[model samples]
Target chain A: MTPLDFVVSLALISVAAGVLGSLVGLGGGVVIVPVLTIFYGVNIRLAIGASIVSVIATSSGAAAAYVRERMTNLRAGMFLEVATTTGALSGAYLATLLPERFLFAFFGVVLAYSSVITYRKRHEDQLLAVSNDRIANYFNLHGSYYDEAEGREITYKVSGTKLGLVLMYIAGLVSALLGIGSGALKVPAMDGAMHLPMKVSTATSNFMIGVTAAASAGVYFIRGQIDPIIAAPVAAGVLLGATFGARVLGRITSRTIRLLFVGVLVVISLEMLQKGLFP
Target chain B: MMTRQSPGPDPQKNVTPEGDLQVSGRHRNLSPAQVAAMEEKIRKIEFAISLVLRVGVILSVSVIAIGLGVMFYHHGDYTSITGHASYKTLTSRSTPFPHSLGQLRRSLVHGDGRGIVVLGVFLLILTPILRVAVGVVSFFYEKDVPMALVTLFVLVVLIASFFLAGL
Candidate 1:
């Protein structure tokens, strides 16, 4: 294909990825990487570099709307960012020390388990009446949002602050090592452990992924892995798509979001398992 | 923080048919006017954050689009360009690109497409960090000292990651 053709096709595909990523609270790297490498015959390193750019684009683009709508838990996101950023820094160091296959397999199993749990909880109501967790109370992690689908305001208390932080750290580590956003983990942590509403969890995860990806982006840039020609179209396309996706998210029911997320998780988990078991 | 009861029925039910807006947080105990004022302040902070993100994305995408146009203009008839061995080398992992601020500046001076695109990406990367900085300011403005400190710590860790990665 011609360079123009290549760029156009990649951008189109990236737009789709961004839509799904934003809706499901993923970074879209899962889609970006495989397509770039398998279909475009791009180098793995360059594909990963492009994925990093796409993740940030998705995060910032969708977050602009999510934050404005008050769907995102800003305090929770910022507080957990401490763990994620520090974990990313450590993950960069651990990259050379640990076995890649083992890490992938471990995380894969974890994702598979979480996906099942998420599927089982798909019908459960998200808002809890009250929470007695002192750490959560002190941090004031509780939040409320106007549910467009339900046509009412939803208030919920947060719990398991410590578990949520630990999970975020792992999510960050996975993101840095795998060159993915790891929003899969972030959503589950917030939704399940932290007792946040599903939409809030997704929005908060979307809000935080950009910063997590930014932590490692500089390194990728300096290493000459980030090709501008490849990344430019991807970034622009994803940003546009994410903006549209953010608009749709508020209108949809939480059940649909969880189901979609579970589907993505299952696919990603299987992919990780394949890589680990085969490699 | 006192939890003030709403004048009407309980608001914590899973389904509130009345659609009464109940905000639960530090402001849950405040009077209706106080709650409205606090919500307004929070909305302003969120608006500021969103504005930063929106502006940053638009600016970066515009630069990237311009750079793409320049590239297409420079290398007319992209089919021929793709057929050449140079294209393969250019797309390869070993392709030489600007990897530092100084190199990026020099390339931009020469009107290089790649440099311009990378600059856009750099701006894209900076947007989230800028948002975090804005978060600290917003939290501080709200007189939420602990939250502000937490956000500052996150900012420090993000900056520290850059140095750690450099090492």
Candidate 2:
């Protein structure tokens, strides 16, 4: 396709991905990249470049609303950024050493595995944990929220600092090697291990992604992988999508939507394996 | 805290259902302070809603602007505009009109779309994984750590994905 055609198509994809990502809080760039590269025949490097822009665009955009609602734990995110960024830096460095085939194979496997787990936990039965932590205490991570359903104030804490940091390290590695946000990793670590509530995890993860991306995006940039042409639109589109998604988050059943999204990932992972093996 | 619940008719539809329009049917003995406190609570919720609205608007605008900017630059090619030390210069091989932009023209060139595909795929897997973190952060902010911790379990598969897929 002509560059114009490519960009126009990309815009359409961005909106769709944004809607999907925001609706599910999964950010479009992650899904958009695979679709562009594996299905549409776009180059992965170009996809990453575009996804970077999209990442910034979506997170920043969505973050605005999240912050206003007091849902986004900006401080927690910024503080933990220390660990996540460090992990991402190391991952980025490691990515250069791994063979392309290995990287591709590895990413494909992660997608497959996550999809299965998502399928298993696609319900409202989920709960949260309220615990103590030096990091959370020092950062004043404990806070209260107005639960709209209960029409009452529900306060919580920033538990599992050490565990969260460990997950962040892994998250950083994946992000660096794959150009994906470590939020997936970070959210679970904080929420499950530390017993944080879901909203805090989601918002905190959103707040932290930029730093994680920054850590590795720079590495990728230096590796001559960040093509502005690609990065600009994807990033812009993702940003838009993310912002829109955040605004509408309250309007939809993100949990259910996310579950369905996991199903889609399974197919994607399988396709990647098939192609990788066959081609 | 989001005081602005969905615009549904169920529970949080209106902030003040009876502003000074008190019902006299019940004993007409309710204290003014009680009524005033309820109204005050609603007002606080309204303020929270307003704050959320403000943030939402900015978020949407930025997303669109940034997405389009990236696309436009990508369409035009950032090499010509950013002028960063690393941008690849556009040559006849990479650009049809190598000399059309005069001084703003890109002088270096080389790109691999496969790299983009790799990046995209990597990012695709990342969204869900990273989203979990955001969910946790949101929980903490909302003082809903209970839910946050439960959702954290979702990361098990994400972690599995990392090791199994090598991401």
Candidate 3:
């Protein structure tokens, strides 16, 4: 493809990835990096730079609605941001040290792990029944949100605050290292460990991702990893696609949709592993 | 140190048919004064958060879109001169453009499409930082001293990373 064609193709593919990602709640960065690296034969660093920008784009766009609706737990999100941002900085520095093969392998492993976890938990929506911890209680890391579909308010108390913080650090590390938003990890940290409702966890995760991504994105920007030619189309496409996805999210029954995307992720993960092992 | 009962997954049982759910969800059984204060504070903070996110995304996407369009329009000129249409050649063959903030601004002032795209991505990065900054102020206003400090600390680390990138 010509450079113009390559750029346009990336944008169109990113739009599809964004749509599928939002539909499955995974964000476009996961798919974009692989497609750019494996399919388009773009340099991995450039792909990562573009993917990270797209993550930030989708986050900021979706966050406006989530925060405005109060579905996002701002206090919890901000509290967690401390750990995530710090971890992101560390990860960004580490990314500079790791070789391309290691980065690819790590990305593949994380993707496979995420797909499996998402698969196993696909049907499980039961909130964790853990007693509130002292740290969580002290921080008031508990809240409620109204579910429009259910048409009622669901109040929840967050627990496992220390565990959640630790997991968030890992999530931030993976986010910067892999150039994805790490929502797959953050959602589980909030939902599985912290006992937040699924809706709240997803919304809060979306809210926090932009901060985590920004921490590393700044480093990447300064390091000159971010290519504006690549980033522009990807950002615009993901933003538009995510916006469309958000509109249809509440209307769709997400189980089948989630499973289908998990399949896609599995394939992509394998491709990443093959590339890493071969290259 | 107020303690509120946690509602279950099935929200129907916790809420009354008479619409107590709205009241409960809105204030978590706080007193009238506390509820009023919390609502006002939440309203103000949410407005700020939403405004920041909306403006940031809109402005950045618009700038990037325009930049992409300009780059597409000039594709012939760029490819004709360079004899190739690959991103690597365009970006890496030259000394690579806009290594610093000053360079980006100067290029943007000259209506360079790539520079504008860089500025757009830069703005996109700034949105979350702005959100964190807003979080600090909102938390302080809510009298949540610890969270305000937490956000401030995060912001510092973020900026520190930017400087530390050189190392």
Candidate 4:
């Protein structure tokens, strides 16, 4: 194919990835990596570089709208970021020491378990009316948003602040080690552990992933793994798609969002399992 | 969904209006006016952060799009570029791209497509870091000192990651 054809086709595929990614709070890396390597025959390193670019693209693109809409729990996100960033710093070191297959298999099981939990809670939006978590209270992590689908303002309390921080650290570590954004882990940490409303968890997760990814992006850039031609179309396409997804998110019900997230979680778990068992 | 009532005989009922400013486990008792004021403050912070993110994405994507155009104009087709032996070596994993700021500057001066695209990617990577910096400033503006410190710590760690990568 001509260069233009490759660019256009890759861009189109990335748009789809971006849409699904932003909607579910997973970055486009999950789709971009395999597609680039398997279909386009791009080098694995370059594909990862492109995936990194797309992760940031999807996050920043979608998060801009989520924050503006007040769907994102910004304080919770920022606070959790403290843990994620630190986890990433250590994960970078651990990446060289740990066995990849074992880590993948372990994380896969964790995701599968979380997916089940998420599925069971799909119909129920867990917006706690009161939380006694002192850490969350002191940090002012509680939030409220106008749910377009429910057509009412939903105010919620945040709980499990300590647990949320622990999970976020693991999420950051996994993403750094695996070279994927790992928003799947982040969503569950907020939704299940912290009792954030489904939309708030998704939006807040979306807001935080960019910062986590950016922490490693500089390294990838310096290493020259980021191929310009491969990343250009992917970044631009994902940005467009994520922007569109962010707009659609507010209109959708929390139940629908939870269901979609559960589906993605199952698929990601399966993929992780395959990589672990097969590799 | 069942709306659960606050579990106690509401201490907030007799509390003075100044109680609204005190940190609490639940914000359920804030009067509508206080809620509005709080929401306004939060909105301003969100707006600032959102604006930063939106601007960053737009700027980076525009540069990348322009870079793609330049690439196509220069090379015409992927096949022709690959036909050259140098192209093979250039695309290999072992050989890194012009990634540093100085190299980027030189390449842009010459209007190199790949260099321009890398610059865009660089900008894209910087966006989230910029957003975190904005977060620190926003928290400071709100007089949320502890949260500001937390954000600053994250920012410090992020900058530290770059140096760690070098090691």
Candidate 5:
């Protein structure tokens, strides 16, 4: 294909990924990197750089709506950001040192792990007979939000503060290393480990991903991974697709589409793993 | 959905009347005016963030799209991609295209499409940092000193890493 054709195709794929990702509650960055690297023969580093930029774009795009709705817990996001940012620093530093093959393998494994986590829904903790720890109280980790679906204000207390911090550190690390937003890990940490409600966990994770991705995005820029030709289209396409996807998300309830998306992720994961293992 | 009465500590202690007004985790005696002002403050902050994000994305996309158009218009072929814009060629640089701030400025002034694309990506990256900066001010406006400090700390890390990436 011609260069123009190549660029346009990548952009179109990004738009499709963004649409499916937002609909399935996955971010487009994950889908973009593998497509660019495996299909288009773009260098993995350059693909990752573009993916990271797309991640930030989509995060900021979605976050504006969430923040306006008062669904995002600002304190929780900021508090966890400390760990994610620091971890992102270390991860980016390591990215420059790691071998390309190893990076590819790591991405594959992380993708598989993320897919499994995505398949399982987190059940809300029912035991309210719990006590608040001092650190949580001091940091004011607890929050309440008006759930439009339930039509009531739901108040939830946060627990396992220490675990959440440690997990967030890992999430940040993985984010920079792979050049994808680690929302997959962050949401579970907040929802399952910290006992936050699903809506709060999703919103807070969205709020935090931008900051976490930003911490490493700068590093990628200086490292020269961000090819404007690749990054510009990827970012623009994903933002457009994600915005459109979010709008359509509420209207559709297609279980088959969701399952098909997961199947595609699995296939992509295997492709990445094969590339890494062989090359 | 389980709202058990926490007989733990006084909810009053948990609720800082000044800093914790926005959060409804614990009950606090707040006046209607206080709530309205807080809501207004939040609405303003959200509006600011929304504007920053939307403008940044739109501006960047427009510039990059224009750059692509110019690249296609002037070259009229895939020669640049084959010759200089290949993955192998682009990846050889130790820093991103345009190399330095001065170089970027010069190229942008010359209306070089590549430079414009770089600037667009740079703006997209900046959107999050800008939002975080706005967050610090909004947190302070809410009288949430601790959260503001936390946000400030995140901002510091962001900037520090950007410069440190030079090393």
Candidate 6:
């Protein structure tokens, strides 16, 4: 293809990636990796390298709006980073050593498990509270939220701190390995296990995933996994798209966006399974 | 064919807030001694984590820059995968390392479905190892027994899944 043709094709795909990523609260890498690997016939390593750049773009763009709205739990995000960054580095090394088939099959299982989690929690959007351990209160993990529906800023403590960290660690690892942002696991873990509000968790997860991705993305980059020709446009496009998504957050109900998120995950999971077993 | 917003960061405003500046996990108050102790511990940990993050970010950027640099430095002389532009043919006609790297890249970028399928599987196995490390890191830092045990569980599941998949 001509350079112009390549630019146009990439531009079109970039826009689509940004829009979809913003909508689902995901960095575009998951979708990008697949399309590059399968349809475009791009190598997985190059795709991951490009995807990491995109991940930074989407996360940085979205994080700004979330912080402005006071939705992001910055403290929680910072606290969790201690775990994720370390995980990301190790994940990259493992990816380099392991063969490709094993990676795909493993990803397939994760996809299936993620499907079940999404399926089980399809409904119910209430914030439940429980007692926190000494650490939760000691760390000031409690906060108030202005629930638009209830017309009040409800005060609540973050429960299940232990559970949330465990999941965040997993989220970081999967994110590094699969080039996904891991908001799918991070958000739910924060919300259901930790009993943090959905809005708060989503915003926090967005803030955190980049650091996680960066940690591992760095390793991949060093080992020569990323390609700039792809990473540049992809990152730039995703950053723009994520900005738009963050802007649209309150304009529409989160429930609408969430169902769409689940649907996308379902499709991704099925695709992974099919490819893993068949290929 | 689609783009994701790639959710993340921009530096915060210069102005400081009246209360806890960031306000995610700030507790109400503590005695001077308690605060000092917590501050010390948190500080120590934060520096380590920050070092890791900075290294990661720097390394990731450098890699991409190198790739771009290589492409540009060779631009006028660059070859495609096919025809007169064929990088493969040029490499075949050229010397050793570039030829092999090009071949590896060709298999990586444009190989069959089976190649990508294998890559995906590798990503999968690698995740658990990564995840377990994360869990252990957090557990040790936080010293939370429950979280540490749960990390073990995730580790087990990851291992079990890998073996079950016959990998």
Best by TM-score: 1
lDDT of each: 0.81, 0.52, 0.70, 0.79, 0.68, 0.53
Q: Whole-model lDDT for model 1 versus the true structure? A: 0.81
Candidate 1 Cα outliers beyond 4 Å, as residue runs? B1-40, B79-89
lDDT of 3 by residue, B42-148 (tens): 66667777787789889998888888777667666443434455555653424376657788889888888888888888888888888888877777776666667
- CAPRI verdict (incorrect, acceptable, medium, high) for model 2: incorrect
Every candidate's DockQ is 0.40, 0.05, 0.36, 0.39, 0.33, 0.06
Against the hidden true structure, what lDDT does model 3 obtain?
0.70
Give per-residue CA lDDT, model 4, range A45-162, as digits (tens).
7887888888899988987766657787777888999999888888878877999888878888998999999998788877776677888877667667788888998877789989
Candidate 4 chain B: 10-residue stretch with minimal lDDT: B1-10
Best-first order by TM-score: 1, 4, 3, 5, 6, 2
Chain B TM, every candidate? 0.74, 0.34, 0.70, 0.69, 0.71, 0.40
lDDT of 2 by residue, B1-167 (tens): 32222111112222224544212111122356754554455455445444543444344444434444543455454324233422223211253221112211232222233233224323432443454455555444444443455435444433533343222
- lDDT per residue for candidate 6 within B1-167, as digits (tens), equals 00000001111211123433333322233466754665465455445433443343334334433443444344544323223443222112122221123344564575322223223222321332453455456555544444455445544444543333232
- RMSD to truth, every model: 4.4, 12.5, 5.2, 4.9, 5.7, 11.1
The lowest-lDDT stretch of 10 consecutive residues in candidate 6 chain B is: B1-10
Those runs of model 6 whose alpha carbons end farther than 4 Å from true positions after fitting are A96-103, A145-156, B1-167
lDDT of 6 at A27: 68
Ranking by lDDT: 1, 4, 3, 5, 6, 2
Q: Number of the top candidate by lDDT? A: 1
lDDT of 4 by residue, B1-167 (tens): 00011111123422335654345643445566755665566666666766777888889988888887787678654534234333334446665557766788898999988888988888888898998898788667655677889999999999999877762
Indicate the worst ten consecutive residues by lDDT in candidate 2 chain B.
B5-14
lDDT of 5 by residue, A166-263 (tens): 99998888788766547767766776678776556655666677778888876777666777778766877887887776555434333333354446
**Which residue window of length 10 is worst by lDDT in model 3 chain A?**
A123-132
For model 5, report DockQ: 0.33
In terms of lDDT, the poorest run of 10 residues in model 6 chain A is: A1-10
